[model samples]
Target chain A: MRHHLILRVVTKLLIGSIMLFALYVQFHGDYSPGGGFQAGVIMAVAFIIYGIVFSLQDVQRVLPPWLVHKLSALGVLVYAGTGVVSFFTGYGFLDYAALSPHHPVHGQHYGIILVELGVGITVTGVMITIYYAFTSRTPVMDDEAW
Target chain B: MLRTRSLFATVMLAGVFSLLSALLFVTLDAVDVAFTEAAVGAGISTVLMLGTLALTRRFESPPAHTPVIPLFVVLVTGAALVYGTLDMPYFGSATAPAQTHVAPDYISRTPHEIDVPNIVTAILASYRGYDTLGETAVVFTAAVGVLLLLSGLRRRRRKEEEDV
Candidate 1:
């Protein structure tokens, strides 16, 4: 019991720290050593840690499997939608310059941020989903033996 | 007791090697790569492998008949690859082909084109957007595969329930 408690506490601290760091990396990525990929991985690691300490079912409760699936799809939509939006705006696909012809740099920054957020969301969702799938018990075991 | 000691030693060795590789990546200014290697290779991989061992047995019976010739060929090939590394440029050398080619274009044009200081981000999202799309598709495909596999099991369970 003591060991479990210790593991729980340590995992929480690690998760919390990674989350805080992820945010820092996201906002400060332009001038820092971290960015979307790093932040995404860190966020995923936090949830994986949570899954390890608590039961996978408990983790699923917090982030349901269906929600994770939706989020994964939603992330791709977010990314692709941003690009498609640019295209409709008379720019080439993923052309941030045309996003705001008045201030192209600002448009570029905005577009990048949107895309990065998408990457983060998809990465985290998919990673957690993978963990969930791997940890789930096989259905065959559920059948009563004759 | 002796086996536990050896397992601990092996884990420590793997950890050290992973840390060293991460440091090497960092020194080469591949910060993104370094971060991933450090986090996944050193941190998560070791933890997951150890967790698997915990869930399963730590040891397995040795193979009754080892494939000595096949093992020897594999080892030789691996050694040759390592030996070939001697002809490669020194690690982190600026004049290396990796730095000399296209990198300068990426570094110089990124600011003017995308206006992002992080060239890696610019390249990943803008310059090589299609490649990124492919990568995302690959991930999506893997997720679909997992879902399909799991859903098949779910279908089997449903059939069993109906029969009962």
Candidate 2:
């Protein structure tokens, strides 16, 4: 599998570009056809492709299983924390206005970004985690097996 | 006639189905839906199915029992759905109850209030913030469940220095 010259080179070129596109989708989602979920999947695909081309062990070395597990929990906390902050500020739970009472619009922008980030992080973590989990148990497959 | 095919071929067919459905969504002007369909349905699912195929047998077992019950169920469900849709308003009808309500408010005020050019985003993240939060939580929960089932905590392998 590792000996495939084209797969390695093409994956190298495609991985960085995919991650970049994921970022673009995340931030520019407000004006585009994407958001956290789509971006998160794209980001995961970048790493998953790397794993498939390079090997699961190599990719996991870069993104350890432990870190991914922790991140899977953290994203929900980040999202819920925004609501908690708003609640403490004497506004409705998850209130965007609480972020900036004077400039409600700016507050909305900030709130949206924060929540989207939380979503993106969780999605990326979960997706990669699942991929790693599935691959870990499987025997190293020969290219000819397919 | 698509029976007894290799798992790879079956997955490829599914991927093609997703791409076709995504194209249909685009034609309906549901760009957001199309994007998701293309990305999640056509892209990630195909990969995941391939992964599963790698782990399991490549070919499906021939049906031992009659598929008549399942076929009848599917046909009934499909007919019910089509019957249900018969009374719905035509596509993009202004008088549709869904459009008559808060959509106009969200569309009209989004520029002044949220200042985001994309009203869909504004509505999804701001107006319907809680729902999105719930959806994210659902995704997180699903991940947690999968982790529990597939890969709970494992002892770090310190002895083997096998490089990836």
**Index of the highest-lDDT prediction:** 2
Model 1 chain A poorest 10 in a row by lDDT: A137-146
**Steric clash count of candidate 1:** 0
Pairs with steric clashes in candidate 1: none
Best by TM-score: 2
Residue by residue across A14-46, what tens digits does model 2's lDDT show?
Answer: 998999999999999888888888888899899
Q: Please, what is the whole-model Cα lDDT of each candidate in the order they appear?
A: 0.73, 0.87
Instruction: Show what share of the native A-B interface contacts model 2 retains.
Output: 0.76
Q: Under CAPRI classification, how is model 2 graded?
A: medium
Candidate 2 has a TM-score of 0.93
Badly placed stretches (over 4 Å) of model 2 are: B152-164
Provide DockQ values for all models, in the order shown.
0.34, 0.74
Taking the tens digit of each residue's C-alpha lDDT, what string does model 2 give over B64-146?
Answer: 99999999999999999999999999998989998989888888889898898878788888888899999988988888887
In every candidate, how many clashes are there? 0, 0
